[model samples]
Target: MPSHGAWLKVGGAMARVIHVFRHPDRFVSGTVGEPGERTFYLQASSESKQVSVTLEKQQLTVLSERLTSLLEEVASRFDTEVPPSAPEELTDTDPLDVPVEEEFRVGTMGLGWDAESSSVVIELLAITEGEVDENIVLDDTEEGPDAVRVFLSPAHARAFAERAERVINAGRKPCPLCDEPLDPEGHICPRQNGFLRDNPFTEG
Candidate 1:
C-alpha cells in the first residue's frame, strides 16, 4: 500500500514526507523473525494505507515505558481520565499486517498528548547519516527527514504499550548470573569466573 503523508518538493527534489494517521484503524509494534533474531517494527494503518518502520528492541521498550509515563502525567497534571491499563477487549494478539515492507529505520521518536483531542501522538523519524535537528522533530516543516505520525486514543495507546512489553519479553531468556541473554547451547558466565556452567540456573 502507498504511504499516506505530506510530501514536500524543494528544488525539484523531494525534501521530506510526513505520514499522518489521524484516526488509524490499527497502530502496533510487532516483530518479524525468531525471538533472538527478531526485527522490531512499528506499524500504523488506516483504511487503505500502512506504514511500517524498524527500530531497535531497546528503543521499543523505552518507547512503551515512556508512553505509560506520559499517560500518567497527563492524568495527574491535566485531570484527564486515563485508563489504568489496557482493556481486555482491546488486547491485540494478532500478528502484524502482511506485506511488512519497511519504509525506514527509526532514528528518533517523539511523543506527546494532544490536550484538545485527548489523544496520544507518536512521531517516528527516519534515520539519517547526519545529526537530526531537534526542532524538526514533531514539527510540520518541509525540510526535515521523512516521518510517520500516529494519533491514538489513550486506551489504544495503553494497549500498544502493553503489547510492546509482551513482544519485548518474548525474547530469549536472560542468564540470572550476569544479566545477559542466555544462549540455548550455553554461554560463559562471568559470575562463574569465565567458566561455562553446565546448569547456570542451578545453585551448585
Candidate 2:
C-alpha cells in the first residue's frame, strides 16, 4: 500500500481518549486474523483538550512508546488470540512516500487485545524476523521532533485491523467523509460531500 493521505475530525465530545490510525490509501479494510496488506491511516490519540490534532511520525512514535506500559497485562491475559508475522525495522525514509496499497509485515509475532486498557499487547518471539516493503515510511519531520511512525508486527497489525474493522463497523456511525448512515459495507452521506444518507427511519 502507498502512504496516500487521510482526514479525520471529531464532531462530538465523549470519551477522553480516542486514537486514530491514518494512512495514505489501501486496497482493503483491516481484519483480525491477518494484518492489512497495505499502508493506510496511522494517527494516534487526540487529547490535550483539543478535539483534533495532526500527528507527525514523532508524535505517533511517542504515543506508541507510551502504549507499551498499557499493553503488558493484556498480552498476558490473551496471549492465545494473537498471531505471528514480522518485526518493524527503523528506516531513513519517510512513510508518506510509501504507497497505501502495498503489503508489509513486521515480524513473526502476536497481538492480544485488552478491553480494559483498550490497547493491543505485542509479544515478539525470536523465531520470526521482521518484514516490511519498499514503501514503509520512517523519516523525520520539522513540525515537531522528527517525522517517523512505527507499527505493530504484521500479525499484530492484522489483529488490530480486524478489531478496528469490527469496532468501526459496529458503531452506529455516519460516514466520516459522507455523513451518511453507515451500513454493512459503509455509508454514503450526501452532507459529507453530496451523497444522500439512506436513513432507515426516513422514507424517500
**Could you estimate the TM-score for every candidate?**
0.83, 0.23
lDDT of 2 by residue, 38-85 (tens): 222332222221111222223323433444433444456654333332
Task: Judge candidate 2 at residue 63 and give its lDDT.
Answer: 33
- On TM-score, the leading prediction is 1
Local distance difference test scores for all models: 0.85, 0.31
Q: Residue 149 deviation, candidate 1, in Å?
A: 0.5
lDDT of 1 by residue, 130-169 (tens): 9999988778887878999988888999999999988886
Candidate 2's error at 75, in angstroms?
24
RMSD for all candidates, in order, please: 5.9, 19.0
Clash list (residue pairs), candidate 1: none
